[model samples]
Target: MERPVAVKTVAADLLALPDWRRTALARFEREAKAAARLDHANITAVYDAAITEDVCCLVMQLVDGTTLDNVIDCADDGRLSVLAAVSVAAQLSSGLSAAHAAGLVHRDLKPQNIMVDTSGLVKILDFCLVKVLSDTDPQLTITGETLGNVAYASPALLGGEKSLDGRSDLYAVGCLLHHMLTGRPPFHGEGPAELVTQHLTAPPPRLTDCGVDVPAGVQDLAHALLAKRPEDRPGSAADVYEALAPYLPAPAPAFATRRMPPEDPQRPFLVPHGPVMPR
Candidate 1:
């Protein structure tokens, strides 16, 4: 057992509510199990979880790291440098690829759920909203409401669709990538209801619109990921990694991070930088 694990404690008030506690703890335990079954360096490891009396505790690997949100905030400006943003997204794609393959869909991915360790290793956290695709149980995601953060929720999810797949998670990765490079999420509104409307109706914006001088290819990738329809996005997380490989700030040492098997050597290489544009 790892010492100094990150332990999540449910608030006493929430624990005292029988209905809320039962539903919340059940989802927490199931998602924790799903995350534990995955073996990806970039995905946070779940060590243990238990509900004692009315309290729920989830113990996870203690990462000596900065939250991705903190990293973004610490940037001299409000956003990450282009290469850094792409590199983070690439690593995240690898982690999500493993989870998707394991039949897990991370429904609530956001910058707050990401961490970059002291060694510059990226790990994704919080699987409390995960859905197990292999189960095909309608009850898994049928709460009559959207389940993820409104700002990052996909159009289908905001529409209260009964089923969501890996593509929905990919949409969030797109939003996360855009946020990393722009210091803001792709969509914004005064409230959750307005945000949902924007996601369902607004056109995907370009990096240039946010006044970031990243490569055109970078913006293009974001657009693909943020496509209003799930089918319009990249086929898989591996495909996303391939699209992002050219912009990775640097190579991983000793292949420490996972990579998809060799693909056609003819993959297109996008230019890494472009002329600086005025904000």
Candidate 2:
């Protein structure tokens, strides 16, 4: 019997460019291996993967919901309510924590790559496709490889740093959080180069400046995550989760929510899924 699964195939165009083809193929293989090793509720599970010169495809768990891109687009003014936004960020942080625990980093994190299941659980997609292509022409390959995701790229990553860690991913989470609450990314640019310059030199935009009414602590947390140096950012994804936990809506009696349905992101936290299990 055939089962439902989400299949991700390497873009043929990527393989057509000699600068991207060779390194792209190898990165696909590494991503496959890394993804297969991770198992977490907030992360899309990888069941199988195959890589070759001509083909590279990954089969993943098929989630029953929409991408965060849709979630953002469908929200008021393209932004979630403060409570709902926190819930989504919390889940994303949880997924990041899991990947960090497994010694993996989700280098590319953006709304297009986040999923919100029907039950309101947020799942991080492509947790292991963190590898950016490196070819003979490094700058060209880097820019091409991270096209859509450069908005969330960390300062260190954009600065040509060879080493990356969980902190880098946290920077993207900051961008995510900012985007979710403000209807826009923390930094806006005319092109990739301008965005890179902002991420590298400009201080991250403050939530207060955006006219969004969020808690002071939450705003501070977002700014700290966008810190330039790795050590300056939150120590780990776990730290981020804890910081946002206070903002999660408290679970109400099941009866209370029957008449008034909970929001998309609150569904997973406000309602019980099953008998509680040991953590």
Candidate 3:
């Protein structure tokens, strides 16, 4: 039997609350517009959307999967295997690259907003906080008004910067990667405000610091993505994808299972050992 298609509609309770109606409606509209703009394999597909005086509706692909938050919680070690983590990161980077190319900045990126299916495919979720990178759409966030999950927010967002770009998403990618491998985010605080301050002023954390034995290159990539200065992170999501390709689970089997042939003294080893990340 075919399952019924899921339709996202404004909650009856929300509609009944006069104080929350306007803001909730605006958020619903923004989410619809943002998801509708992108056509990417790793992004959720929006089929349709509409708004009436009191009701908001969005029809989208029924993603039959759990959020990354649940995946993390279900893991016994509180983290994914290295291959699984890399695969998730690569797919996420591809999706973000496509969105950035289309001038969209996913302001709210976190485990709760990323879905992973049974096939191991990733589908980014929720654009209620998405920002359109354009001159006309000035930053809606004012100074001291932060938006996004504190743990995954970029320094710019935490600092309440008036502008954001693809790098902002890249920062959240770094946080996600760190969490996937280390079983926790790179930084944490006792409260939300302190968490934002940590994002703004804390030094990038290393995967090694958490005892995760991933390749040094992966560790460096995480640090680069989490750089306090946006200019220091990978220039774009495309760059991130390139760096993560070798570790992703595809074309090649498990990176840990591949055995390098022993070196012969007579002939020089043509290929270097592993990916050499830039400092």
Number of the predicted model whose TM-score against the real structure is largest: 2
lDDT score, residue 50, model 1? 80
Write the residue-wise lDDT of candidate 3 on 56-117 in tens digits: 88887777667988887777688887776877788899999999998889889999999875
lDDT of 2 by residue, 60-179 (tens): 999888999898999988999888888998998988887887777787899989988766788888754564322233432454344337788898877767567889899999999999
Over 4 Å off, model 1: 52-55, 136-145, 252-279
Off by over 4 Å in 2: 16-20, 52-55, 131-148, 255-263, 274-279
What TM-score quantifies how close candidate 2 is to the native fold? 0.87
Backbone clash count, each prediction separately? 0, 0, 0
lDDT of 3 at 95: 94
